[model samples]
Target: MNLGIIGQAAGLYAVTNIDDILVLALFFAQGAGHKNSTRNIALGQFLGFAAILAVAVAAAYGATFLPGSAVPYLGLLPLALGTKAAVQAWRHRGDAEEEKQAGEGGPKPLEVAAVTFANGGDNIGVYVPVFATAGIGGMSAYVIVFLALLAVWIAAGRYFATRPVIAKALSRWGHILLPLVLIGIGVLILIEGGAFGL
Candidate 1:
């Protein structure tokens, strides 16, 4: 229960998690000008982050059982999701209003959670080593810090959703951009992890 270590862990998480702000902003922006629920986004983020923590903990304990190569393949989850969105976007390219309306139901909480978890491949990469070293108490502190910061993360994203300029652009182009971003993130994860030796 060292406050200093928790603060340090929180800072480390803040630094490493900057990109998540963009992903979350995009998620929050998904139903721009529609009835999107911030609750879903926040809850999905928590679930996703919780999943990442579980993976890191599992990796810490089961490092011998899982092959190093297997980690990167986790990228496929987001890749598949992004590709689906991209194809749907292409199919309805001419029907801009309909496309927006289709998204009005907003991304499902599970969908958001999956994307968030899949995109966290890098976080797992970093967390595994930390968990290996942190021991149980320190790990618990880090987990608490991570959960605390998630609130800030969601707040920032919701704020971004409120901005007129950002909101408008997301409203106009989010359908196209969201999928590409997700796919790019997946590819980057695979590349970074050296999955398939690519």
Candidate 2:
């Protein structure tokens, strides 16, 4: 429970995850009308982040289970998701009934989780060294702080999504923008990770 450790963990998480706010905001906007949207998003975020942390911890402990070269392949998850969304949007274009039906269901938890995990490739890279240097006690503290901050991140994203200007824009264009955003993120991840030589 060292204050320094807590601060360090918080700073690290903040630095690594600032981009998540926009992603979560898009998710919130897309899920606005669904009954279980918030719950699903939160659950998916936690599950996905947990997986990232697990891998970082395992890698820190010298588990070579997942090689660095394979990290870029994670980009395919978001790429596939974006492609699916684009196809759905194209198919439902200009059909109010079909578009409404498509929008009603919101995103699935696994879909959110997959996106979160796919987007966390850099997080894993940043965390592995930190976890390696941190002893058991320090690692525990970091994990606790990271999880708590994730809740805060989700809240911030929801807040941003609810702002009148943002909300209106998202309501109007989120479907189209979401797919492009996802695709862009996927490409960025792939290029950065050198997946398939970009």
Candidate 3:
């Protein structure tokens, strides 16, 4: 039982990392002013996290297999996403400046959901490790971690969504930066994946 508790604690510790914070911040910022979209993102993230959990458990339990060394391949996901973001940014470069003057056109529910899903791609991988570590014995611990993360995630979203200046600035620069941010994260993952010779 004590070992189970320890396992749970370890899982929680792993999931609540700096990466999670940054990802949460990006998602929150993107969701600002779009309640339905934020809701969808939250739901998507939760579901995505759950799916990763299942995959992680399968890897651990032998329903699937990957050498720990192969985990780095996940880096490709972020890299691809980041590159896509960069391309999108490039494609919409002119629109970005024009949109600033035009102001937020209107609430875009579907677009918000798509953006949320894209932002969530990286997070899904993060959850995989947590689930693999937590396992059936540590389900409670995983739930606790999930709830804690969810609270902070939603609160961050709410706080930023309500801030006029922050919202305005994000509205203006978000298009320009989101792709770059994704690209940076992708590069970081690739570097980390290779740094120790993954």
Best by TM-score: 2
lDDT of 3 at 95: 70
Clash counts per candidate, in order, are 0, 0, 0
Which of the numbered candidates is closest to the native, going by highest lDDT? 2
lDDT of each prediction vs. the true structure? 0.82, 0.89, 0.54
Ranking by lDDT: 2, 1, 3
Task: Give the range of the ten consecutive residues with the poorest summed lDDT in model 2.
Answer: 95-104
lDDT of 3 by residue, 1-198 (tens): 356665655555455443544554455565555446566656655555555555555654556554556554555555575576567556656675555323433223433334333334445455566556666767556656555665566566657645788767766676555557666665565566573563
Sort by TM-score, best first: 2, 1, 3
Better of 1 and 2 by TM-score: 2
| Candidate 2 RMSD computed on C-alpha atoms after optimal superposition onto the true structure | 1.5
Which segments of model 1 are wrong by more than 4 Å?
33-36, 62-66, 96-99
For each candidate, give its TM-score against the true structure: 0.89, 0.95, 0.64
lDDT of 2 at 117: 95
